[model samples]
Target chain A: MQFHTLFSKAVPLLWYGSHVDKCEKLTRAPGGTRLCEASSIVVYKSSLLQILRLVACEVWDHLLHFVTLLTHRIIPCLDVKAGRVVKGVNFLGLRDAGDPVEIARQYDEAGADELVFLDITASHEKRDIVYDMVRKVAEQCFMPFTVGGGIRTIDDVTALVQAGAEKVSINTAAVVTPEIVRQTAQRFGRCATVVNIDPKRVPRDGFEERRAEREKQGLFAPHAVIPDGQPDDIVFEIHVHGGRTPTGIDAIAWAQYIVELGAGEIVLTSMDADGVKTGYDLVITGGVSSAIDVPVVASGGCGSPEHIRQVLTETDADAALAASIFHYGEYSIQETKQYLHEHGVPVRLTH
Target chain B: MIGIIDYGMGNLRSVQKAFESLGSQATILTTPDMIDAQVSHLVLPGVGAFGDGMTHLRDRGWIDPINDFYKSGKPMLGICLGMQLLMDSSEEDAPSRDQPIPGLGMVKGTVMLFAGDAYGPGKLKVPHMGWNSLNIQQDVSLFADAPENPHVYFVHGYYCSPADSNVIIATTDYGSPFCSSLKQDNLWATQFHPEKSQRVGLKMLENFAAC
Candidate 1:
């Protein structure tokens, strides 16, 4: 169910474009085997695209770097409140970070593949974000950046994209008017919109019993991981309005639905792991990622460079979003990327 | 002055800004008349659908001027969709079950989507958004002073498959090594955005502008 109240700005994401044909020739070739199915990497192992192995060291580095960049993104997320970057624990206990424009400049200089700006209080406060801020930030960064929070209508998405946002996110509004996704996709192109799904973990007791029961029932069951002393494996529930409320929607199901609706990507945030920084909710992220044909950006609870490395390596997520870790200078985006590159995750390094 | 055709599509500002950043004056040309004595080079920047872009090029009456500029023996560049428009036709409309849209036919090729949905499990997303290496196929001024296999920014769902592979100056892998940049005489086009690509992109734009 959609939350009736908004305590803070909840992130909504939209992805549209029949490629919006960004470049006349850099076409995102439209045809393809509809949503790849259990394909083999073996197909590419001997292909030219995977020819990094035979090249000389330096060329190999450059080629693999390109591969890493094409497949992964280390996105610096700015959780903006009152037009300033802020960090909150569990979407509460907010701490002032810095001015958005300047911090954005820092991320750009530090080699962020993409930038995400969430007006953390826009939805909770029920106010439209200032397009001027979006415009200012867009001008400051050459890389494509996405903005989320409190966006409810086509005009909201249009205003943000027009103000230089390559992508506009929809969270709470998606629950209220899911069709907004279709309308925005039709108008903006399927690649321009993204659906932000913040799912909270809910208890599913007798997990072993349920896993066995589901297997008997033939539900195409999820992988069961029952930790010691836990009541059963947990299933994630979609949340809206700043993680203040939970919906009946299943996280993986929602991800699949959004992609079918033409949303280009899913920004899957884990409420259970929001600000503790233990790490991302890998189970849900990987599950949702595998369930959808589009890219899934794993958000929430990144405490260190290793955390970014963990989410990316351990999950199928195409990108990872972190706020406080980068904002407070715990790790520069370059450091995070370098760590990833060193650990063999293949991130583009900025000199 | 470098004249950027303002056929009313795509990210035009950044291209102009990129040229400005390189200490060159790039102007957005909306009318064919603006293709004047002051402007030595032309750029066609594009975004949005091919049909709509062609309509804008037609409604704005830029088809003749752009083609004429190509004939003037002066250098011209088409970025992204502007580059694809130089091809003969595109399959971007195929998803709607519509016939392939016709293009300017400047380059011999048919623009089509990657095989399959170009989306889903175990496949690259159609937009193929992000940075990738450009495999330089030939030594052209566009890549002069640029590094070999330079990584450039790309964001597209369809790609131009040139009938004449020789015109393809460079190739970038995304399902396969589709044409990433192509040059024929003074006419240049890139699927990747040189403006957003930082150094390499700026260098290519600068090289084109220098002519």
Candidate 2:
């Protein structure tokens, strides 16, 4: 997720002092229902524009609508590998936390609105999910939780829901068989299926040699560079298995496809922004969000409260997902919410 | 005293911790002599391929000790793969591929791969991950405080279909209703991982400990 680093310095006056009319209008939908009542909306707008231009519009809209009708959400993600919580830079150098249940408890107590547990090894290991971990976490967690990683079958989704998870997130399996989405949504409710897409900017042929060198050194591949004379310069594509294989499919196209296939929500994680804490890739979030009507979760790079504020305010994302910064206690959920609230962002403050 | 029989296949530490959580001391015993000397209650935990699990048990001379433990009329709990080992034979391993390697024979069934269309052709992925509600078949001590449809964590593709359904203590459905938990006399087994299962799972351990 590529985030705008300039957002912190560009704090708007509307963020600090809320205009009563703007605040009320923000809380009320254009149709006059409560903001929360408009959780689902019909898509009436669709147009293709230059990538940079589209991103700029999204950022501007996100800022103008910062906290009006749409409320911000807090989601805690669990990266499960070998039945344990593992984290590394750009999906490499995995280190084990004590146990998934322990980590889940810590996040649950820290005021997380929802939790995501990704079975990072499910695909590579060709194994079933770690039910032991899911069962342990589900029994105690009160908030809605999503389980991802190794979900390959409808039975897997059934078992996850039965075990207590509220939703299931699919990536590799969904891409391999799109029907899985329709089948799962039909079996379980549509609201229970979340599709997570890991995407990276495909580098151009000229930069291939440089990209190969960077990849060899375990660095992120450079964004595809456009030839000096070419009109179309960069194309964003989906990356699978921790950004190792490039699908060459446009992120917006895939998002629309999955949503049509019955995905209730989409989680767009930027390979470049992931783990950097710099910010979310608003460019991608905006593009996908504009294409689909379902809730879009902006993931990957989320560093400071200001970054979150920027994404929630600027893009059409319904929620923002952060891992390292929140996991390490760099900032609290309350602080993040407070910061957003003080700014023009609408938030539900707990008494 | 509780003795966790180690055949070098499954996870025993979490089970040991679960027992300890219930305020009981459990020992992981690897040898038959150790089983003969100190074991008052026995727990056989196994993972990986079923045939490999049984081979390790037999190679370690745990076959007779486990059978003896059953004959001794002591409480014995079989978990996941260990539960499969309690059956007559398993199709998971090759040598015993078609041949039926003898099990504890306490339960009359064979461990077979789930064959059904609910998962679709090559579609229903194996290693049935996540949790499922255990449908109580017959009232058993292991489910003392467990709810009517208590969700238990499961992680295997193969399940034991006991010849006599009367012995099935609990059943769960993924594609079909299969044995989720089993109990007959002092012999008890569960296909789900209770140790890894949270509150209800711990409650199950407490029930087993009390038993």
Top model by lDDT, which number? 1
Interface RMSD (one decimal) of model 2: 15.0
lDDT of 2 at A249: 56
Across B45-69, the per-residue lDDT of candidate 2 in tens digits comes to 7655666676688788888878888
Candidate 1 per-residue lDDT, tens place, B1-211, comes to 9998887564466677778878899898868898898989999887667887888898999988888889988999988888999998898765553678889998988898865243223345556666677778898888999875676777777889999988999988765578989988789999987777766677888888887
Location of the lowest summed lDDT over 10 successive residues in candidate 1 chain A: A4-13
**Candidate 1 lDDT by residue in tens digits, A1-351:** 013111111111011111122221222234433233233222222232223322233343333233333646878777777676766322212232356777665666677777888877644344444577777776555666788887878887887776767678888888777788988776666667788999877775533454455457654345443322234547566778899875555677667777777687789899988889999987788677756656788998889888877787556677898877766667777778777765556555632
Candidate 2 lDDT score relative to the true structure: 0.68
Q: Each candidate: RMSD to true structure?
A: 13.2, 15.4
**Cα lDDT for residue A232, model 2?**
52
Q: Which lDDT tens digits does candidate 2 get at residues A126-220?
A: 44446767767765543446888777777777767656565689887786677889887655545567898997776444335545765676653
Task: Please list the residue runs of candidate 1 whose C-alpha ends up more than 4 Å from where it truly belongs after superposition.
Answer: A1-71, A88-97, A121-129, A204-233, B95-98, B116-121
Model 1 / residue A242 / CA error / Å:
1.3
Q: After superposition, how far is residue A177 of candidate 2 from its true place, in Å?
A: 26
